[model samples]
Target: MKKCTIIGKTNVGKTLFLINFAGYLGLKFLDISLCDDKKILKKYKLSINQAIYELVNDQTHKTRCLQSIIVDVPMGKGKKKLQLIDTVGLIDGIHSNIEIRKAISHTLTIVRVSDIILHIVDAASAGRDELPSSMGEVDYQLAQFAQLKRGYAILANKMDLPDAKEGLDKIKSEFSGNLIIPISALHKKGFKEVRTFVAHNI
Candidate 1:
């Protein structure tokens, strides 16, 4: 029952990675797929409150069948369970408020409880842009966060682009010895390592 929050700023592939990573962990997740179905959300008028209500109502039934709900298959003969959470919110060195800080501060709380922090980086974005992308700030913050608990792993996503691999040397030097993997989620490359990592860590 280890809880792992896929922590990063908005649009940094946190939600997408959770689904992909769950597949690697042998879980049959039906969450976001249902959320994406326009027919369903449309049938309910696509209101956020209604969606929340439906989710809560549905989970009550699912919770009664907890084992069947959580575990998809016997991985290495029924040895493990993985819990993943994806979050959205923005933060920066520039503008912020107590509310925003409190939300971002929850990341460190998640850090404390996770067995491993899988820090995914948008490799192409950070090296090209002079300004800090979410990856840059996330890297620095999680580095500081890791000083306390949960060893972190870096996944250099979006590696399909030539520009992504172009600055590998620099990124490697910056992260030093932490396991930084070059993987393109779009291409399914580098997932074997990611799969092995999850199994090994938890």
Candidate 2:
């Protein structure tokens, strides 16, 4: 199956996007596969609400591993099942915590192999300075590296906030020529465009 990985700095709504995107795709229950550094996969099942409550958090690096779910994208008549993986949040400087560094390494490894890359950035934070979720050096490097892939796009998240417009404009100016989809992950806005992009690529 094709794999689509969601990556971004912490508190940028990567986890919320994962769960809500699945919910947008009509999935009532998520069958999640948590893959660690050793490549050992542990499975769990949860409803959309349950998944959000348990997994989504405001803390930095809350997601320590690869959390994956299989979702069916409608094709001509049948459907295409793709592996949508949520990754640990990445930071600019070297993370002091060893485990987080390892998780970041694992996320990078997954990025190298993924068929599609959905790079999420916080639009509201992008308008601000020095926030954890603000666009940084890592995001720039990621855009450069993922350029080799055909299915790379930037998701400007948190559009519901007042500051997001400025952030989105900044992202557009900085990341020109790249495909960008403005989305409010919390409210599920701009999901149709995202779904279309995924469908066309996958």
Candidate 3:
């Protein structure tokens, strides 16, 4: 299956996007597979609400491992199934925790092999200054690297925020050549465009 990985800095709504995007695709219960550093895969069945409560968090590095789910995208009369993988958040500098550093390394490795890259950036934070989720060096580097891939796109998240428009404009100016989709993962805005992009690429 095509693997589309959601990557971004910590607390940028990657987990929330993963859960809401699956819900937007008409999934009430999700079959999720979580893979640890040892490559041990564990599967779980959770409702949409349960997944949010368990996975989404405000703290940094809440997700330590790789979590994946298969979703069917509407393709012609039938459907195309692809894997949506949520990775550990990438930080700019080295993390103090050895485990977190390993998780970040794993995230980078998966990006190299994934079929599709959904690079999410916190638009609202980008609009402001000194926020943890603001656009950083890692984001710029990731954009440059991932754009070389066939199915790479930037998702300007948190568009519902007041300052998000400014942030979106900045992202557009910086990533003029690449495909950038403005989305509010919390409110599920601009999801149709994202779905279309993913479907065509996958």
Tens-digit lDDT string for candidate 1 (78-189)? 6666655443333455335564455455445555667767676667665575334325665676766664554567877768765676555556878786788777655667
List ranges where model 2 is wrong by over 4 Å: none
Q: Could you tell me the TM-score of candidate 1?
A: 0.68
Which digits, one per residue and each the tens of the lDDT, describe model 3 over residues 113-154? 899999999999998844689989999999989999999999
> Local distance difference test, per candidate?
0.52, 0.93, 0.91
Please list the residue runs of candidate 1 whose C-alpha ends up more than 4 Å from where it truly belongs after superposition. 32-75, 94-100, 130-134, 147-150
Better of 1 and 2 by lDDT: 2
Query: Model 3: how large is the Cα RMSD against the reference?
Result: 1.2
TM-score rank, highest first?
2, 3, 1
Candidate 1 steric clashes: 0
lDDT of 2: 0.93
Q: Which pairs of residues have clashing backbones in candidate 2?
A: none
| Clash statistics: count for each candidate | 0, 0, 0
Candidates sorted on lDDT, descending: 2, 3, 1
Worst 10 contiguous positions by lDDT, candidate 3: 33-42
Q: Lowest-lDDT window of 10 residues in candidate 2? A: 35-44
How far residue 163's Cα lies from its native spot in candidate 2, in Å, is 0.4
